[model samples]
Each structure stands twice: as structure tokens, then as C-alpha cells.
Target: MKDLVIVFPGQGSQFAGMGKQWFDGNRVVRDRFGQASDLVGYSLADLCFTAPPAEVTRTRFAQVSLLVLSYAMYEVMTEDRKIPVSAMTGHSLGEITALLAAGALTFEDAVRLVKARGEAMESCVAESGTGMVAAVRMPVADVEKCVEEFNSGGHDVQVANYNAEAQTVLSGTLDDLKGLTAHLEDRGAKVVKLNVAGAFHSSFMADAVPAYTEALHEVEFTEPTVPVYSNVTGEAHESPQSIRESLAVQLTSPVRWSAIVASLVERKAAVWVEVGPKQVLKKMLTGAVGSGEVHSFDEEPERVRAVLDQLVELKKREPGLVGLCLGAAAATRNRNFDTAAYDQGVVLPYRKLQELSKLDQETLSDEQKQTALDLLLTIMRTKQVPEAEQRDRVESILRRTGDAGLRTIAGALAT
Candidate 1:
């Protein structure tokens, strides 16, 4: 494995005795947890390690508790161990742990960010806003279309969490969520109402972002010693300034985990790690790399006596191993190569091409592939499409592999 990407879980993953086993034996882990408690002033250890279930279950306890354990586990693993940590990323609430682990923010800074985030999340939920529910076994476009249909019918709903293929969560006002849930269930999704207070990661969170942004300005984020892949674009952020802004927007923005996974896999990452009590992040990562190996924070104590056990074992078996890599876009900018826009508003299983490239090889069958190549030429040659339409058409091309079984679709690429 070249680089290690450790993922962390968010609010719902917390429990009263999350890291007790490790904390009992590890002086370093205890010390770090105490450090977080001192910064928060009220004794996070009391709330995390020893609080009653009811208290620990509060939003106040839930968010902070999760962060403390995740950060401490990370410290125990990396402080004296030889973990092959080349890069890292975290989910919604876990982003703080990632920032701290990547050296972009101090432990104190991350805890404070968590304090504000928990408060913000709580406040947003307190409103008469609707709830959130995960809808599984449905296509992305179908899920999106379902949200659209609900809204068009006067329910203010949108897809909030895009967890993985066939799994997504939606959010809106209570009525909106309820109505959409019914519609989505009718459309064949295994729906589960999440145990979340408010609808997060949707427009419903817009009101909370400004306050969070202002909070960000009060703190200073360092240029990360490691690049932390952001959920905003599913790519590594450029600087502290960019990351600060991104953190604020993250509450309201859709988590592009699929894109993040695509970027990591496209780069052929060595291994991915999940640094939380449960394997929630591991599940998300499995979607990205079905056959890949992943190291996580929830292993047994004796099993993980070393933080980088998997790394040592991996390297011993295969030293100097490198993965097959995708070539970069030809230096000549292909402004027309993006396949995202074309993917929008269209059915998933019905993917079609919108760009022109790679019709020469055996990646595609001869008949359908040639038609796609021709479609690309039509748009580029005619320039007849509205600029927006042309852009969509171009992306549509690249997103589709092997063409859509249409001679018209394939042949249009050569235009």
C-alpha cells in the first residue's frame, strides 16, 4: 500500500463505552482524551467513557463523544507506530478528525469545531424541519427524480446523503420527508427513517452555514501536512483557506462520497482506513473498491498492537508494489471531456455518451462504439447545441462506456 486513507464516522456511531478497552490500557489514549476534555472544560471523558446512555445520546454528547474517540484512536495508532499514512479523509462530522490527523488543525481546533458543529446541527434540527431517511436499492437518478417529484408536488425535499449506489438519504420538512418517503417506498426503495434530529446536508442546512463560516474565521487552519480529500468536490483541497470555506459549505452540501471514491480508486490508493467505533465508513469505502483491503480503528486490542499491522504485512508480501493507473487527460485541454452533466436527469442504467474519445481500442464493441464516436463529432462540428446543451452532450459521451447500442449515438461522436 502506498498511501493510507483513514475514514471516520459521524454522529450516530457514538456509544457510552466506545474506546474503553483501549483507553484502559493505553496511557497515550487516556492522555489524549483528557486533553480534549480539558479543552472543552466540562470533562468529555465523563460524557464519553462514563456517561449514562441518555446523556451520551444527547446531541451535545453524541457529536463530541464521537470526535474524542476517533481522535484518540488515531493518536494511539500513529504516534509511535509506523503507519503508512500518505493521505486521509473523513465524512460529515469526521472531517475534524481528518483535519487533525492530517495536521491541518490541532486537536483543540478540531474539538472546538466539533462543539460548534454539534450546536449548529442541534439548532438546525430544532426547527420544525422535516426528518431524514435513507432509501436503498434504487438508482441515483431515480432517487433524485423521486425528490424532484415530491418537491414538484409541493413537498420541500432533496437528496441529502448519497451514501452509495442503491443507497441514499433524503431530507426536507417533516411533511415533505413523510410524503417523499411514501413516494420512494412505492418506487421500490428499502426506506429507513434515520435517527437524526434535523435534515442535514440539504438546503435545510443553509441557515446554519453562515454561522459556521463565521466560526471558521475565528480559527486558523494550517496548510495540511497531508492532503485531506474533501466531500465538497471529492478531491483534495488546495489550502487552509479553501478548506476553511469548504468546511462551512459542507453542512449544506451533498457529500460526494461516490466522487471521492472514484478519485481515490482512479489514483489506485494503496489501502483505506476507517477510524471510528463502527464500520460505517468501511461500508462506504467497500462501495468504492469492492475487492480492496481496508484497515480500521475498531480491531481487537491485541490484534492491533501495532497501528500499521496491515501495512507491515502488505509490504512484506509485496514490496515496491504499484497499482495499474489510468492515464491523465491528454495535455491538450478537452473542455468537452467531462461526463458529469450528461449524467444528470438521465436514467443510470440508460447511460449514454456526451464526449468524444477512446473509440480506437477494444474497450467498446465495434458497432455501438463507432456510433458514439460519431455523436461526439456531431456536437463539436455543428456547434449547433446551446452552450449548456453542448456541455451536457459532451459529458454524456465520456460517462457512457461501450456506447448505448445506438448507431446514432456512436456515430455522432465523430462529428
Candidate 2:
């Protein structure tokens, strides 16, 4: 509730036994894994929790597995734990997860979409012989410069992911990644070759675009109920079309991660919860914000409960702390906590709403008060609250405004 954002990690976050506890204990978690397995024609639980490292890490398996686990965790957080999120973002494959959580896509559609995406990317990797490498302790600019210099004459290489301020991943032909290592090391950057099939998020993925776009077109999209940032632009998606376009571009574009983190910070997101199988995103986010603010929920009930409890206490102290609970990361948008706001028959304490929304309580005009109430009603409706309930809450809050016409208008809306 404390101006929090939920982030989902990408493919490499997977490991043997990831999400095993949830699969063992939670029916909802197991059910989701089953759903994914049925859709993908393989046991996702086996791949995510029991498979050999090599097999689980395959691009095709890794993508769907991460989505299933991340969404399961998101389900626990929202339905069971009731955590509130303000915004959401995801890394690479994680971006699909983000879109799912934002209401831009459905679960069945996402599963099919990511499956197609992974297969497409895997085919590209297999056919092109492209690879990826991570460069650490180097500014993103320096990493880009190194790629440009190495690519100026012959080979094709580009920055694949702007992961952090001083860490980036590069993608190119396998030989090109090897070729650039020495020059990067000479510049004091630690370069390690990643064990990935193809150069994802690079021009090598161009062939994967059309097919994935077709899958995307088959899915229905709605504007996000809560702000969701885009990995392509590192900003809040302006509309459903923008989200769709960005998802398509993400196939052959570098992930603008560091910029996304900075954007979240600018938007007043203070605490970051990484909902996935591992702490990969939490570690990266810790570097962006101080370590005290990031929590990683992998499948440990105690750890997950501890973070949820912490956020609940936060909400208790600041009842206005808006929490955007993700129903399913990359599938469902903010759900439970937004209800927590309106369930009280008011969005927030008058003074707190003024502070958070930056609207003056002493505003001069009745029309402005009506406008604010209308916007709140619209948001509650977008969250899909029943019409009668939304209007009741809005009318309850509007009663505090001493304007007769405003209360009458609220009554009219309730009808």
C-alpha cells in the first residue's frame, strides 16, 4: 500500500525447485501450473520445479514457466494475501506478465501468446546462431559504445537489455559476443557470456515479430486498471494500443529496464515487490532503490507472509496508502486493494486524498468537486466494481462536499 509497484522477473529467474512450495501447498498455484501444462502440452510444474537445469532453462520452456510461476505468486498476493500495488512492470519475458497483470490480456491468451513467442524466439536462435552476454560494472553508455565500435566494421551486435545503471546484456551472433568480450574487459567491464539460445530483443528476433503479432491480435486488450510501465519506453503505457504496439516492438528492441525503474521512482513508487520464482528482479531493484524497500516472494510462505504483513501494517498507519493488488501478474490488473479503498464508503480520508491527489480541499468551485468525484467513479468502474456499488461509494464520499447539486448528481449517478 505504500506507493508500491509489483515487478515480475524474466526467463533467467527460473531454477530447479522454483515455486515448489506453492505447488505443494496451494491448490490455486497448482491449478495454474496445470492450466499452463495443459495449454503448452508439457508439465510446467516438472519443468519449473523438477527438471534438470539445462532442460528448464530452454527458451521455450523457460518463458512459459516463468509466466506461470509469477502469475501464481501474483494470485496469492492479491487473492490470499491482499497486497496492494500502485503500478507494475516486468523485465523481458516478464513484460508479458506485466501486461497480463494490467488487464491488457487474458490468461488463456497470454499462455498461448507467450508459448508462441518462446517458440518463435527459440527458432530464431536455433537458426541464426545468435547469443547473449552480460556486461557488469560498466555504464550503459560505455556498453553501447563498445557494441558500436565492435559492430562498426563487420559483425552485428547490439545492447539487448539495459538491465541496470552499470549492467547491460548484449546480443549478436555467438562469435560477435565472444569477439567483444576482450575489448569490454579492457574497459574494466566484467563480461560473462549468457547461456541463452538466441540473441533475444535484438534484430536477430525480427523474424519472430509477425507471428507473435498475430498471436497478440487474437487477444483482447483493455486499458490497464492501474498504471503499468512499458519495457520498451520506460514509461506508463498511454493506452491499450500503445501497450499492444510496445509488446510487439519488445520482440526486437532492447529492454529499457533502468529507465523503467527510474520512471517508477519518479512516479512515487517507494517499495518494490518482485513476484516470481527468484530474487533476480529484487536484487536489480535494490540497486535502484535502497535495499530496505524491496521484497522477493519466491514460494516461501513465511517470507511472503512477512512482506504482506509489513505492507498491511503500512496500510494501517496510512489508510490512504494506495495498494494496487495484481490479480495475476501479466494477466489480471489491480483488484483487491482498490476495493479496500472504496469498501470504506470513501476513497481516503479527506486530508489524505488531498495530499495524495494534490487537490485543494478549499477549492472554490462546485464544478471542480463534481469533476473529481466523476474521475473517482470512472476509476472504480474501470476496476470493474458493480455499478451500484461504485455509485454508492462515490455518493458516500460526495456527501462530505456540502454542495446540494453535487449530492444530487451523485444520486443521479447511483441510479
Candidate 2 has its poorest 10 consecutive residues by lDDT at: 321-330
Please write out the lDDT profile of model 1 over residues 146-213, one tens digit for every residue. 88877786567777777787788788777777777789889898788887778888888777777777
Off by more than 4 A, model 1: 300-307, 310-415
Indicate the TM-score of model 2: 0.76
Give the TM-score of each candidate: 0.73, 0.76
In candidate 1, residue 63 scores what lDDT?
83
Q: Write the per-residue lDDT of candidate 2 for residues 1-415, one digit (tens) a residue.
A: 3566788999888777788888888888999999888999999877876779888888888899889889987887777555555678899888789878767788898999999998888877776778889999998888889888988979788888998989899988878888899889988999988877888898889988998999889888776656678889988776778878999989899999999888767655777888888788888878687433777877354766776688766655542211111111112233545566544423343323354345434443665555555545545554556667665454333222213234444454555
Evaluate all candidate structures by whole-model CA lDDT and list the values in order: 0.66, 0.74
In terms of lDDT, the poorest run of 10 residues in model 1 is 321-330
